[model samples]
Target: MSAGWLRACALVVMGLFSVCALAKDKQPTVIVIGGGLAGLTAAYELQNKGWQVTLLEAKPSLGGRSGMATSEWIGNEKTQPVLNKYISTFKLSTTPAPEFVRTPSYLIDGTYFTAADLTTKQPATAEALKRYETTLDDLARSIEDPQNPSANNTLHALDQISVSNWLDRLQLPATARQLVNQQIRTRYDEPSRLSLLYFAQQTRVYRGVSDRDLRAARLLGGSPVLAQAFVKQLKTIKTSSPVSAISQDKDGVTVKVGSVGYQADYVVLAVPLRALNKIQLTPALDARHQGAIKGTNYGWRDQIMLKFKTPVWDSKARMSGEIYSNTGLGMMWIEPAMKGGANVVVNLSGDNARVMQAFGDKQMADQVLIRLHAFYPQARGAFTGYEIRRYSTDPSMGGAYLAFGPGQISKYWRLWEMPLQRVAFAGEHTDTLYPGTLEGALRSGQRAASQVQDLAAGKSFEPAKVVPVAAAAAAGAVAAKKGNFFTNLFGGDSDKEPVKAAAPIAPAPAPAPVPAPAPVQAPAPVAPAKVEPAKKATVKPVAKKPVAKTPAKKTPVKKAAPVKKPAAKPAATQTQAQ
Candidate 1:
C-alpha cells in the first residue's frame, strides 16, 4: 500500500475512542409539553435517568392549576405508593392538624351547621346522607378496574345516564340532595350534567376516609412544593414557550414553538387534554386521542384567596374557615399562615364558577366579602386584601381539572394514556387513580418517563399498577367525603379492543352558557405572586383567642369593567418554575 493509504488506516484505528465518546454524549432526548406537575415530574424523572429533556410551558409560570390554588391536601395516602415516595424523596412535610381549630362547616341559606350538628339536630337529613353514601360505595365496588371500567361490562348501562338520573332513582330527600350538590357542584356540574359511571369511579375510593385526615396529609407548603422540587432538579425548562405544533416521523418527534422546532426521540404531552385544542399535531392524533382532546370534561373554578386582619373565623368564631354551602360562594378552607392572621380560600365551582364570570373581579370579591359578612358579622372589619383566580378565563389553564361526564369515561378511559407513534400522554387527566389530583399528576409523570425510556430501549411499556376486581370489592363500603379525580393503573391495550369516540347520550340540560368573561385585561407580566401569610394559630372552640393580622396580598378595589390592556412586553415571559 502507498503511504497515504497506510496513514488513513492508522487514523481510523486511533479515532475509535473519540467515536465512542461522541456516542456516549448523544443521549436519548424527550420534549415534555406543559410545565405543570405532570410535565415537571416527567422532565425531572427523565433528566435523572440519563435522558436529555426539554420542558415547554405555555403559561408565564409552571404548576398549572396547582399554582393557582391557595394550597393542596393529599388523599388515599395508605393506598398510594407513588405519593409516599414523592414525599420522602423531596423531604416534604405532612402534618395532622392542618392548623385549623375545628372541623369544617356547612351553609344552607343563612344558617351554618357543623358536620356534627347535621347528624344531631337534623336526624332525617343525616340519615338520608348516610344512605346515599352507602349506595355509592356499593356501586363503586362493581368496577374491578377504573381505567378499564368496561372490564365489568355489565355496568356499562350506567354510562348511558346522568348522575342526576341515578340520584333521582335513589329517591333521596330534597335536603340530602342539596347537600350532595354542594359536595359535587363546584368540581362537577349540576349532577344533572354529570355521568353515573364517572361518579361511580370517584366513589370507588369513597369508603374509609376521614376529611380531617385527608386535609391533614398535605405538603406543608402545599402541592406546589412538588413542582418547585422538580424545577430545581431539571436543566432545560423553557417557561412561556407555548408549543404550537408537534410532529413525529420515522426517526423522532419535533415540537414547534412559534418558529422554532425542538427535536427529540419522543414527546410527552403533559397538558390538559382540552389544551390540545390549541396545539397542532402533524399527521394528527388518532381518532381515540383526538376524541379525548375534544370530549374530556373539565369544569371552571373561581377561587378568591383572601387574607384577613385576624384569624377570627377560627379564634373568636370557633369556625374552621371551612364552609360548604348552597350559595354562589362555594367552599372555603384555612391554609397555614405566617403568624397571627388567617388565610382563607373562597371557591366557586362548576356552574357557579362559570356564572360568577359575569361580574368584574371587584364585584366578585365584594359579593364574596358580603357572603362572609352576612354570617360572621362579628368580623366585618377584619377583611384585608385578596387575589382572584378564574380558571375558565385563564388563557394558560382553560378549566380546573377532569370532570368526566356521561359516556366520556367508558369511551376514552382505556386510551387515556396510550402513546401514539412517538407521543405519550401524562397529566391528572390520564391517570386512573387519583385522577385530577396532585398525586395522580406526579404518578402519571413517572409512568410517562418510564414509558419513554421503555420505547427507547425497545422494551414493552409497563402500565400503572392494577388492583383485582375481587380485591377491590373485598374492601367493602366506605364513605368518600369528596375527591377531585380517582382511578387505578391504566396501561396499554394492544390486545384489547380499540377505543372509539363516545356515542352521545342525551346530556342533561346544558348548564347556562358558560358566562362570557368580562372584557378583561390579560395577565400582566410579573413573577409568580408571592404570598406573605400570617403565622398559623390553633382555634379553641370555646375560647376567644387573639389573632394576628395576615395582610391581604392585594388592595381592595372598586368594581370596574376590566378593559383589555395592550401588552407591555411579550405575552410569553419565561421564569423559574416556582
Candidate 2:
C-alpha cells in the first residue's frame, strides 16, 4: 500500500481503539437534572458505583430545596446553623451547632395552645403511644433489613391509605387527631389531603424507636455538608444549565441544556415533575407517565424562620420542637440557635402558603408576635430576629415536595417507575410509598443509579422494588393526605370516590376560648415592629461530629411482591378540577 493509504489506516485504527477504550471503561456520563436530595443522592450513588457524573443544577447553589440558610447571629461571634443534618453523613455540607434556642408561637384553632403554656403533661394516650411504637419498630425493621423477603414489593397492592383515613378508622381523640394532623400537615403540607401510604412511609422513615432516636437524626442544618460529600467524588458539575430538550437514537441520547449539549448512553431525569415536563422528549413518554408528571406538582410551604432572645413564657411544651395545630400556620417547630438566640421555623402550608410567601419578613414577624401575645401574655417583647422562605414563589423548585391525593396510586404510581426509551425518571415524586421525602428522594436516587448501572453492565433492565400489600397492611393504617393533582389524574375513573381536591372540611369547630392568661409588663421598652430578623445564624468552625458510616452497600437486586391490578373501588374523590 502507498504511504498515504497506510497513514489513513493507522488513523482509523487509533479512532477505533479510542472508542473501544471508552466502552471498556463502562463509564457512562450521567447528568443529574435537579440538585435536591433525590438528585444529589443519585449522583453520589452513581459516582460511587463508578459512573462519570456531571450534575446540572439550574439554581445558583447546590442542594436544590435543602441547603444552608445564612443570616447574622445574635451572639458574640457570627454563627451558622445547620438546617438539615439528619442525612449529613450521606453527602451534604453543614456545620456543628455552636448554640441554639427557641421562639414563642401560638395555636390558632380558636382555642390557642402556646409553646409557653399548656397543662396537659401526658399528651399522648397509652394506645396511641403503643401504636406509634409498634409502627416505628416495624418500619425500622423494614428499612434496616435489606434482605427481608418483602423488602422490594411494597407498592404492588393497594394496601397503604392516607392519614385522614387512618385517623378516621382509629377513631382517635380530638386532641390526638389534632396532634397527628399537625404532624401529617407539616409533612404533606395539607392535613386532610395526604395519602396514607405516603404518611406511613414517612412515619416509618422519620419516626424511629423514639422521638430522639430516628434515622441517624440531626437538628436542621443546610445541605452544604451533604453537597460536600456528594460533590467531592465528581470531577465536574455545571450550574445554571436548564435542560430544554433531549433525544435518543440508536447509539446514544443527546441533551440540550441551554447552549451546551450532552450525549450519553442513557439519560436520567432527576428533576421535579413540573420541570421534567418542560424538557422535550424525542420519543414521547407514555401518556400515563406524561399524565403523572404533568398532573402532579410539588407542595408549597412558606417558611418564616424567626429568632428570639429569651424564653419568657412557659407552660409545658418544649420550645424547640414541633407544635401541632389546626390553623393558617399549620405547625411551629423551634430550633435552638447556633448562636445565642433561638430559631423558630414556622410552616405556612396549604392554601395560605402563597399569602404568607407574599408578606414581608417584618410583617410576618409582627403577625406571629401578635398571635403569640394573644396565646401567651408573657411572650411580649421576647422576639429578636426574623426571615422567610416561600416555596411557592421559588424559581428553582415550583414548590416544596410532591404530594398525591386519592386514586393517585391507581394511575400515577406505576407510571412513575416505568422507563421510557433512554430516558429514566427518578426523584421523590417517583417514589409511590415514600413520595415527597428525603428518604424517598434517596430511595429514588438509588433506583436511578441502579438502572444506569444495569445499562452500563449490558444487562437487561431489572424491575423496581415493589412493596407488598400484606406487609404494608400488617404494619399499620396509612395516612390520607391527598393533593389536587391526584384527583385530576384518577378522579374521572370513579364517581363514587371521595373527592380530595374539594377543599377539605374545616376541622372540628374551635373549642370555647378560655380567658387570656394574665399579661406581664415588659421588662424592656421594645416595639413589635423590631421583633426579630429571620436570618439563620452564620457558620461556625467546630470539631466536626464524626459522619455516620453508610450501611454496607447491598448488591442491587429486585424482590417481587404479588402483582395484581389495582382495586377498582375508590374511597375518596376530588370535587375541584384544575
Candidate 3:
C-alpha cells in the first residue's frame, strides 16, 4: 500500500480509539485497599451513599483476622467455624462459643491453690480484696471529679510507675499478687512492661473482675462472620489482587494490583499497619506519617485447641478451669465442647505464644498435661487429639492488637491516630474507645464512615479536639463501672491533659429582648353564613339517539325478448328470465 493510504488508515483507527476512551472516562470509581472490618465497612458505607466501590482483598476471602478460620468443639464433636459476628448481623446462622467450665485451681509446682483458698466468701477477713474494693471505689469517685485532689494527682503519680512495681509497693500477699498478675496478663500480656496507669484503667474498666461477670462473657461469632458479610454485601470485590505500587496526584490515585492498574477518585488504605510497610507510595508519606507507620507495634498471641474422647475432669481437685503455668505457656482455659462430645480449647497468649510455637503443638500439650496431672494426679491420659493455632505465623493478622508501654501512651498516639490524605486508618487498633476488640473495630469503622461522609458532603472537619478533663473523668467513671481497660485509658484526660472548664462560655447576652408593642384592640366578629350552598344535584346524562341513513335504489335488470324465450324453450328453457 502507498504511504499516504497507510497514514489515512491509522488516522481512522486513532479516531475510533479516542471515542471509546472518552466513553469510559465518564464513570467514577473508588478503590478500597483491604477486606478487613474497616475496609469492608468503608466500602459498605460508601455504597449506601450511592457511590461506586471496588474492594480488593489479598486473600481469597474477606474478614482479615476477624474472619480467620478456627475449629470449634462441642463435647466430642468438632467443626470448622468462621469466628466473626458480622455473619449474624447479616442474618446468617452460627454456632455459639463453647461454655466456660469453672476451673478453680492452678497446679503450679505440684501444689493446688483452689478459689476458696484465695479469698473467703466472708466480707471482713478478705483484707486484700477489701483494699481492692476500697481503691476501686476511691478511683471511681475521683474519675467522676478528676479535678479533685484525690483523683487528679493520682493519675500523674501512677503514670510514673510500672504495674509490677505498684503491685510490689501495695504489699500484696503472694496469692493476691498472683491473682492481680493474671488479670494484668489477660489485659496487657506482660505485667512488668505494662504501666500502673494501664492497670488502674483495667481495674476501673472491669469493676474488679469477679466470677459473676466472667460467667456472662461470650465471643462474638469471631472474625470469619464479619469477612463473609462484607463480601456478600459488596457490589464488586476483587480477591487475590495485592497492590504493589500506588501513585497519587491531586486529581486521583493510581493503584497497581498485580499486572492490572486502577485509577480512583478517592483511595482508602484499609490494610493493617504492619502490611502498609510493604507497599510503596508515590510522592512518599510525610516524614511524621511515615514515622507513625514504622513505629506502630502489635502483640503476638497464640490460641490452642485440644480434642479428646473424654473430658479431663478431676473430681478430687474439683478443677475444670484454666491454670497459670510458670513454665511459660501462660495460662490455659478449659473450653467446653458444644458438639455433644468431649473436646476442649486452650487459649494461650504473649510469651507463651512465642515459646509454644518454638516447641510445636504436642510438646505444648504434653507440658499442659503434665501441669494438669500435677494438680489432679488423675486423668494423666485424658487427651485424645489436640490442635493448635499460632497467630505469630498467621498471614493476615500477624499479631493481635497494637500495644503501648509506659510513657509510650503519651507519645505518637495522636499522630498515628490521624487520617492520612484521602486515606483513613481503622481497625481495632485505631479505636481509642475499645482498642483491640470487636467493639473497637466496629466503632472505628463508624468513625471512618463518618469522616468519609463529611468529606463527601462538603462539610469541614477539624482534628478532633482533646477530650476534656471533666469528660475524661466522667468516661473513666463509666469505664471503671464497666471494667473496660482500653476505654479507661483513652476515654479520660490521659491524652487530653484537661484544664478546668473556661467559665462555661457565659450564655451570649440572652439576645437583647425587644420591647413588646401595646396590645391591639380586638376586631368585632362577623356572623356565620345562614344558607348552605345547594348541593349539585345528581344528573345522569341523557342517552344519545341513534342516527339512520337513507338506502339507495337498485338499478333495473335488462330482460331478454319474449320471442327468444319461445325459441329457447326448445333449447331447454335457457332464457326463462322475464
Please give the clash total of every predicted structure, in order: 17, 69, 29
User: How do the residues 230-335 of candidate 1 rate in per-residue lDDT, one tens digit apiece?
Assistant: 6777776677678877766666666777766676778899988667778987766668667777776776666787778786555434556566776666777655
Worst 10 residues of 1 by lDDT: 569-578
User: For this target, which candidate reaches the highest lDDT against the unseen true structure?
Assistant: 1
Top TM-score prediction, candidate number: 1
Which tens-of-lDDT digit does each residue in 1-578 have in candidate 3?
Answer: 99999999999999998986664443434677777777777677666655566777676656665522243111111110111234445764444433333333453444445545545442232466446445544444334422121133335334444555545545666655565565446445555555455445444443434443233223334455455566666776776677666665555556776655666655667766667776777657777567656554455555555655556564554435555544443555554455544544555665455445556457777875665556545446655766655544454554566554454443344444455444556676665534555445554565665554444334444554433333334334433444332323322223334333222112112112212212221111111111212131011111231111222122122111111111100011000000
Displacement of the residue 452 alpha carbon in candidate 2, Å: 0.9
Q: Write model 2 residue lDDT over 326-396, tens digit each, in one string.
A: 55556766665558766666777654564454456677677876776665565666677676665555544
- Candidate 3 lDDT score at position 100: 34
lDDT of 3: 0.48
Deviating ranges (above 4 Å) for candidate 2: 1-27, 48-50, 67-175, 200-208, 215-221, 312-318, 351-362, 377-380, 393-395, 432-434, 462-578
lDDT of 1: 0.62
Question: Between candidates 2 and 3, which one is better according to lDDT?
Answer: 2
